[model samples]
Target chain A: MNSSSISNYINTLFPQFEPALREKLIEQVTIKDFKAGEHLMQTGQYFRSTVLIVEGRVKLYREGTDGNEFFMYYLQPGEACALSMICAAKQESSKIMGKAIEDSTILMVPITLMDDLMKQYPSWYYFVMETYRSRFEELLLVIDSIAFNGLDQRLSFYLQKQQEQLQTNELQLTHQEIASDLNSSREVISRLLKKMEQKGEIKLYRNFIELKK
Target chain B: MNSSSISNYINTLFPQFEPALREKLIEQVTIKDFKAGEHLMQTGQYFRSTVLIVEGRVKLYREGTDGNEFFMYYLQPGEACALSMICAAKQESSKIMGKAIEDSTILMVPITLMDDLMKQYPSWYYFVMETYRSRFEELLLVIDSIAFNGLDQRLSFYLQKQQEQLQTNELQLTHQEIASDLNSSREVISRLLKKMEQKGEIKLYRNFIELKK
Candidate 1:
């Protein structure tokens, strides 16, 4: 009875999923929700299920030694958390963290059924591979940004990414927020922002920065 | 005839692989060799097969904008290149670079058989998942080092990693080499090494740094 609602969510959110695989998920999966600003997963926590996002957004980041959040990537609706899948499969603790940037829903597929799904559903296996590949590539890009670029260049890339990901010219982030994400000081980020503003690349407002198109 | 040699190598290096799975690989996979310092995969290059190391070591790193290489992790015998598996499956170009740190032999498994192997062999599927999980975890650790720690701490961690991975107290790398790997200036690294020497952690020499017992 409750599964019917799950089936609806799965069908709408993951239209590309094979019918048989969706049916399998509906039979075995449970729904979980997180409010905005909630921590969905924390460092060193073990997950019992493979998580599939159904609605809203989840932000993934690494927790620094002093608990500062270093932004990594985002999880949108109709996607899976690659770390959850891997950690669940291996029964390992997570080293990173996941938080709900917006109220979000996810399908919790039990780790017990993972091997069976991989064997029985080709689409499921492909999805798993694709998720790993995409997240792996994202990490490589992050490494490249930090390894190759200076603070100014990294700021530029980060803003560009946020602009593209958020789909808006107005980025609702504070100088301190950007500083924490980039593991720099607020003063440094503010100075960089001022430089950008002077260069006509951005316009700073009270609560948001307008990216000049 | 050629397959028998491959079979022997597979058996010796990866005994944990299921017998049937190893047989399938011997029948279908081809062996490729890389001399030390040779590039196996470069930025934007596409791979024809998933690479599994059978002998020696591969160093995986990110290529910076100015072509500086930032070390990520090492791949030793009996392990598969997780990115190779992903890119080969997706028909995508590699974002990271791989080089033979030691003269290496690898088995190249054609992408066409990846699906069949996953479905037919449970152990093979597990290996694939394990490969992805391990590499993903390594990347997270790399992120943590760069994002959270200072240059001195990172260097300490790097030298410790080198000692562990090489199974020796003597590290045969120059300051310039270590600087390139850590994406830092040679002067800074040399100063840090001198500091470490003052503290009796390691002894600086012409071509190598020897750890104090």
Candidate 2:
């Protein structure tokens, strides 16, 4: 909202960044907000700046030709967008989509100052590297799931991830939504979920899933 | 190899690097050779250095619990191993496997110098970023294929990629290998190839396939 609040956001959420780097971010960043269910990023869009989430949640996914979305991962208040950095550094168009699942806010750092920041601040430099490293690992995990695991195992993993990210056992998602996120048919997802329920792994409701602890 | 040969390798393969950085690489990088099929990287192994392919081809893949190798992509001359950099930066263990598909040589740059190089050489910094970007995009494409496409389409993409990378219409591969790479059954791959052949797209022999123009 204001300079002081922006400073508070940086200092509180990204205290690992050096004081001067945080000051630079406070000075240069343009804060943008997105309402729930709004697109934060879209495929074929060129990124002008890298984004750091300051509030709420964002889900990143790959879109299919048929408009199906294969869910990737989420960005929380303290995380930076990996695709944003990758596309921004190369000035290339995004191959994926990001949506704000909740009312969200992000601070955008211009690409022009990337080299300067990497050189000027050691903390900022490692922060960028660490961001790439974490996101890279996340992508690798996603690949492992899709490549090695069966659909039932993948659904289990999907539920586990949702539980971990939302920090709740009750996942507010429909069967159709799960089917869409996994790029599977609703009938198939329903069959697998019913099997999970039979196995005592979960309880399914109309629009939510309760995972057994 | 001799220092002069190493200098030649750097000068010839990576002329984009500044002279000073090239000199530094020649001084610090260890030249290691791998016989065909030798492991360059293993799942759960720690990485001490970032690898750059100087000669021959390396196949990077995800290994499943049953030791199934889902082909990721190939790393050729002038390319750095993105997983190597990601794991080295965090001193984390690798999650994937890399093998020399052909007899190969690589320049191993110690992880300790990564920070110094990033801060000192703009070219080196951008090179590292580009390596990660390319690998990330490759992984995304793999995800897209698996999540969105059916087996037949996936097989076609697999063959197309193989043709492009091997730079030959005649692919020196077996049905078993194709099935293994795509994480499908040998019979299924054979059936798909037969269909492609019936369509006059290719001619399959004992160990290789010849793509028709």
Candidate 3:
């Protein structure tokens, strides 16, 4: 996208950004693309920049010593992944692997620029405050689901949420991905999906599932 | 604590506050105390100010339908809360409740004071940024634990963390409190605690668990 388009998008999301500051930010940002399955970052790497997704998707996951995996969530266009990690784990240790779910483009803002902008702009502080607040709220939801909600309810809620957010009855998901998200096994997720299909709640396709009305 | 003491604490935590800005903040803050189990703020209450804990502790949690409770950690002295909820959730829709854990005193800085401070002392932006970053980080750890760890592991981890952070081998926690935190039944938690005690990993008192190293 052109600088003008980026500026407009940024302005729409944060109306506090002044025209001059927007211009400076647009100048500082470098948009880069990645194909599916490309790992953009991994555990132990220093996080030196904040990323705003311009297109496509990324998933953050951590692997355990027992060879098990837990999927945090997916980052969509316009969302951020690094900000939360950096804030929580510090710049050097906030390492969850960021892998491409598709051909993705991201607007990268270097930490140096961010530090400068935070100093120079009051609006930037407000923006950061809001972003962190939303991240906090999202994490609370995830925690609630894991603590009280069972796997069946969690999976159902996930599918319902996905159907609503993606605006589609069909989902581009695999059993293993769903398993990783719910902290269960692929076989368990497959069995659950089959059960749901038999109950007419959804239909299992080759690589996807379609929710039934 | 007097204004100088409060300012000194603020300065120690936030470098940007320095001496002069810290003095300014001390002028704007007022200290007040709450008795144990007193509601500092309820779910539907609008957050008109942010608080800096000067002494004692505060519990942050949410009560769901059917009277089920979920504990979202406590705010220790020198910590702050509610900036994210104030910015993100609609005034009446946020699902959180804050209460004084004991007879506690806090320095309250009204939102208007903060607004003025941000304008007059842009350097103090770092103070808000630091608090916001820590809140965001804590939320991520909660999310990570929920997504990857089981109920037993979560309880173990929570006890271990509290032991470390509080710098005490004996944790003043009730079975009901532990159940609320784990989002499980009190009976279950009581049984588990008894089992852990029998296994010689811990010692249980009337309202506490002493981790035996």
Q: Evaluated with DockQ, which candidate comes out highest? A: 1
Residue A38, model 3: lDDT of 92
Top model by TM-score, which number? 2
Considering the two chains of model 3, state its CAPRI-style docking category: acceptable
For lDDT, candidate 2 versus 3, the one ahead is 2
TM-score of 3: 0.86
RMSD of each: 1.4, 1.0, 3.5
- Clash counts per candidate, in order, are 0, 0, 1
DockQ of 1: 0.87
The 10 consecutive residues of candidate 1 chain A with the worst lDDT sum are A1-10
Model 2: DockQ vs. true structure: 0.86
Interface RMSD of 2: 0.9
Query: Rank order by lDDT, top first?
Result: 2, 1, 3
Q: Which 10-residue window of candidate 2 chain B scores lowest in summed lDDT?
A: B1-10
lDDT of 3 by residue, B95-203 (tens): 6777887888777776767656655665665556566666666665676667767676778878987887678999999998888776787898888888888989999
- The order of the candidates by TM-score, greatest first, is 2, 1, 3
Which portions of model 1 miss their true places by more than 4 Å?
Answer: A1-4
Off by over 4 Å in 3: A1-16, A62-67, A82-90, B1-16, B82-93, B119-123
Q: What's the C-alpha lDDT at position B108 in model 2?
A: 93
TM-score of each: 0.97, 0.98, 0.86
